[model samples]
Target chain A: MELSNIEKLLEKYFEGETTISEEEKLKVYFTGEDVSPDLEKYKPLFEYFSQESTVAPTRNITLKKNRKSWYYSIGIAASIALAVGLFFTKTAPEPNHDLGTYDDPEIALEETKKILNMVSQYMNEGKEGLVYLKEFENTKNKFIK
Target chain B: MKEGAFITLTNTFKDKLFRLAKRLLVSNEEAEDATQEILLKLWRNKSKMGEYKNVEAFAMTMTKNYCYDKLKAKETGNLKIVHSNYQDDKPSLQRQLEAKDSLDWVGKIMNSLPEQQRAIIQLRDIEQYTNPEIADMLGLNETTVRVALSRGRKKIREELLKKHNYGVV
Candidate 1:
């Protein structure tokens, strides 16, 4: 391409009017060593643009690594909380052994006495069976005599 | 979109996304983080990726917005010159040093450009995006993009000319 043509393209480029092909022609001309001395000043600018493009960020960026995936963590956390809640709800309802007892001291004492008397009466009945066994043994002894 | 298609879409424009991030943030690490962030967003929205006509442009716009938010959050510090690729091995050490110096100057000048202009220049010149695409990415009209590009180029040219006595024998 003629130098004048490149000059025209550069003008359009500054105004942001150059088509992609025209800009390509400009980059090609400026990148070469044969540029007219007057145009040498514009070379670094184009070179900078090209150089800037070639610059890959020094590190590889893997998107998967940086994704926090908090939803999964939140799901696990919520499930654990629910399980613990259900366990506490199921096991925490044991009634106290003191339930159904009278609150008045006198009434409670009377009830205790009644329970004790019932236990003693049952013991006396058990002793009466021993007395019958003793009479039977005596009758046997008299017959022997 | 399917997972396979999502990956393909990302692979297609990942570099452009990274470069745009790098350009805006001026830090490779931040740019890498931004790119990963943008890609992850795209991955999550992979189901809706098909809704857009131009995924590449959409990704670029996302990066632009993300980097801007990061800037607002004060995540990136002062702009740093990252010119690792501008070196030429064939040149003499002295010429290489001179070129490096030139690139450093350009980087500084680029930093000095207004944020919008800087974005416009990078999209138009470095990434070779069309004016309409750049307009969409920056959320500006075509005329505004052109004006910003013009102003940015002129400033760089004027500064370089002042420094080097450009066009002098």
Candidate 2:
């Protein structure tokens, strides 16, 4: 009678109709000592399932601590420190325009020549006008005297 | 999810992930590494944990997908070989020596099964997940899960019975 009950459960189990409890019953019966001679072949199936489930990961899992709030605070502090540092660095230095200083001697010489040429050209133009002014002043003084 | 909730979730499902990985990959080092990788992924997505309705199912799905990808990579010879000192719980020597015993040879039958069937058997028989949960993990409907499970289970039984009737002992 008990053998017939196991047989029925085994049939249902193969058909995938056995509930968790029914399956548990089947497992208990199959793994127990004195399984029916007719049902001896089914013992390993249950034994394998039960044994396989007990297998654990031998390596220890190393999960990092979340510390979400702690990390958030640290992040905020770091950002604030960065903002403050940036503020000081930005304000401490006055905005200075480039005066066109050249470190290279060749570049300096070229720039000096270009400036001197511009100055000489302006001076010559001013001299030409001054010559006409001087002639006008000399004539006016003589005639008036 | 709460801060503590993510840790709690990983702690609960890590073993399942490892077991599922082993079932799919059939190697201990690969399974362990796969579990570690899956947990790391879950940790990276911890903020989105609340988005999943069933976190356990979601984690199982991830583990399955990761193992499949690993298997594919392995087939293509694109996988970097992972080395580890950890050993798997192999079938015992006595179990192997008992040539007449039908119970001990299930592992060989399981290994011969197709990947999908093996996965279904693992999730259903060993892990004891409901058909619906197995469906969600494998991305199949309940009916498909049931049918495949029945077929796989029956095939395993038939193979066992074949060995018994032949009496190799």
Candidate 3:
């Protein structure tokens, strides 16, 4: 790469007319130590661009970290949410469980019959006392006659 | 795209993405954040990635837009240079200092550049994307891309020449 060629390329570069290869030639010439003094003013500009290119992110973005199975992650997250929802819904108290109501119709019917039978037996005892009172009233009526 | 293929596609250019972000946003932390976001955004849209002919250029375009939005939102900040790879073992201390000064100066000059020009120079010169690729990434025709790039390069050169004449070295 002659200095004349580089000079022409440099002019072309500032004009935005240089080919990519021609721009590469300018970067190559200027980054090396042996630039002619006349082009020294432009050295820093080219060197700045090249040097800037060498700058990688100081902290790695850790593509590896992000590359983990995102699908598996999404699946785990969804399952956990569903599990939490299910647990809350299941553990919440319901109104009917505390009541002593029977679930089976046959058992409910039998229990109802037994309760009514006990009530009728108490009623029959009271009615027998009333019969004694009726006999006492008949004897009183005979004495009055 | 498959996960494996998507990862490979993005892994190749994450640094370039970061560099472009840093170039436009002028902050390492912000640039890193922007890179992460853009990559994640790419991942979220990976289903649609197959629709494009060049995913790399698409990603670059996204970063350029993201940074422009950020710049519009944050209208003020100083230029901060982060050259992690430039070594400290220069044989002569003065030469190294001079290089650093020049870099700092260039960084400031670049900071004042219009966002479009900054993006153009970053894509074309540093990333070495073809002019057509750059034009496509920026949503501009080839002529506008060329005009902005040369204008940017000329501005930097003009500033460098000014510093030289002023005995700033």
Candidate 4:
């Protein structure tokens, strides 16, 4: 292509109107050893783009392994935690509160008697107070008559 | 797509995905991670592959999205562009050094561009994608893509011109 054509292409290129082929031509011209001083400045820009496009990652990636590693570890940890939870839940002993009770039948009877005696003593004190009330009622009845 | 067909399709575009990721993330390891993740996602959803008219474009879109998300998630402040360190086959050692230096300058200029503009230039110039295709991948109108591309190229060109005239590094 003529230098005139290259110049026109560069103008269009800067305007973002050049077709892909025209851009290709520009790249080829710039990449050539004999680039004119007029357009030589643009060579590095295209060369940079060309070089960048060819960049394949140096490291090889295993899509399956790398993608799954973290999730897989979490999944396994979660399942283990759940399993341990279920196992502990199933095996946990039932709570028992029977430690404070008397084991001997005689001792149990003696404690019940003590509680009943205390209850009767309080009841008798109330009964004694009622006798005074009976006498007061009798006197009032006589007055009314 | 069938499994076999899906594998073939992925193989064809995996390099493109890696390159796009590398361009955006500016790190090979992160780019490789991004590519692997995207490919795995595509493989997992191979059943829905038929829905997309342009799978390559769709994959490229996924790569762009994933790389952006990665950048957002990263906490590091000083992310630098990783040059593929591509050395041209110039004959003279001095010429080779000069070429490397120029390429490095261009890389820095590209790194300084806004993310969207940088992506537009990468897709349009390096990937040789058509404007419409880039628009599709970027979720922008074709005219918007063109304007951004123009702006990006003009900025780099102006800088290069300045350097050429002033002989400044």
| DockQ metric for all predictions | 0.44, 0.42, 0.43, 0.52
Error of 4 at B135 (Å): 0.5
Estimate, for each residue in A1-145, the C-alpha lDDT of model 2 and write its tens digit.
3888888888898998988788889888888998888888888988999998878899876556334557999999999999999999988877779887899999999999999999999999988887888889999999998
Chain A TM per prediction? 0.52, 0.49, 0.43, 0.58
Give the DockQ of candidate 1.
0.44
- Residue-level lDDT tens digits of model 2 in B1-169: 5547777767877788888899889899999888877877787888887798988899899999998999888889875667587665754566457545454589778867888889999988888988888998999998888888889999998888776775354
Instruction: Give each model's whole-structure lDDT.
Output: 0.82, 0.84, 0.85, 0.85
The ten-residue window of minimal lDDT in model 4 chain B covers B90-99
Tens digits of per-residue lDDT for model 4, A95-137: 8878778889999999999999999999999799789888999
Clashing pairs in 1: none
Q: What is the number of backbone collisions in each predicted candidate, taken in the order shown?
A: 0, 1, 0, 0
Give the TM-score, chain B only, in order for the candidates: 0.80, 0.81, 0.81, 0.80
lDDT of 4 by residue, B32-107 (tens): 8888888889888888888999999999999999888777777476576776987565335653354358888788
i-RMS, every candidate? Answer: 1.3, 1.3, 1.4, 1.0
TM-scores of the candidates in the order shown: 0.69, 0.66, 0.66, 0.74
The weakest ten consecutive residues by lDDT in model 1 chain B span B91-100
Candidate 1, residues B60-109, lDDT tens digits: the string is 98999998899877846557688988976453555345545786767767
Docking quality class, candidate 3: acceptable
Candidate 2's C-alpha runs over 4 A off are A65-145, B1-5, B78-104
| Chain B structural similarity as TM-score, candidate 2 | 0.81
Tens digits of per-residue lDDT, candidate 1, A10-84, equal 888877688877887888888888989988878877778778878776677665574477777888999999999
The residue-by-residue lDDT of candidate 3 on A22-130, one tens digit each, is: 8888888988999999988887777888988888777766544664478789989999999999999998977676668899999999999999999999999889888
